[model samples]
Target: MLYAYLLSVVRTVAPIAAGWLITQALRLGVTIEPGPVESLVTGAFAALYYAAFRFAELKLSPRLGWLLGWARPPEYPRT
Candidate 1:
């Protein structure tokens, strides 16, 4: 479903954004290929961002559910 695809994309935002920032910072005033350190730090930052956003969405659904891939709470069926 498109919703699932959207969630997948949303989930990557944190890692991608963090990687970009890290790359830029690492490249400052020097030229060097990315290494394990960059990757490890980026991964950690991504995980933190993902957890925080998901927590916020959980605690404040409907208001911030779209932050990082929330399936949205189920709705009751009307009779």
Candidate 2:
């Protein structure tokens, strides 16, 4: 149960963490001389971050909510 909860939280926050890291990296000093390489790297990182975030929200949100108490799990249908 504890592991499940922890995973849920991590899943929710992982993308944000990645995005923050990328943003910081970009802001601190992106001395990558203007070129397609810089744009490619930045765009790739942004896309990866967004994709992770989107997948987590779409696939794990309900489980996360239930695990974190933001919402309840649906009751199983009875026979």
Candidate 3:
């Protein structure tokens, strides 16, 4: 549980970092300016994106692990 929780934090921070990276990229490529308000809004967007990603990952991780052969099946006793 704690591992998952911490992972979620990373999940949350990843989008924020990605957003900053995007802003940097856009600043380099285009003349569009980002204001303080937009930065705050982008932070919110990043948080939301992180939350959704975490939720989705939680929902899908088990299935993905099984598909990837990382999940082991339970052993059955012979009748």
Q: lDDT by residue for model 3 over 1-79, one digit each (tens)?
A: 6776797999999979998997997889955457966987898898687656555546766444344334543354543
**Which ten contiguous residues of candidate 3 have the minimum total lDDT?**
65-74
Q: What TM-score goes with each of the models?
A: 0.41, 0.39, 0.35
Which candidate comes out best when scored by TM-score? Answer: 1
| Candidate number with the higher lDDT (1 or 3) | 1
lDDT for each of the candidates?
0.73, 0.70, 0.67
For candidate 2, write residues 1-79 as lDDT tens digits.
6776797999989979998986898899865566977887898998787666555656877545433334644464443
Residue pairs of candidate 1 with colliding backbone atoms: none
Q: Let me know the TM-score candidate 1 reaches against the reference structure.
A: 0.41
Supply every candidate's count of residue pairs whose N, Cα or C atoms clash at under 3 angstroms: 0, 0, 0
Distance (Å) between predicted and true CA of 4, model 1?
Answer: 21
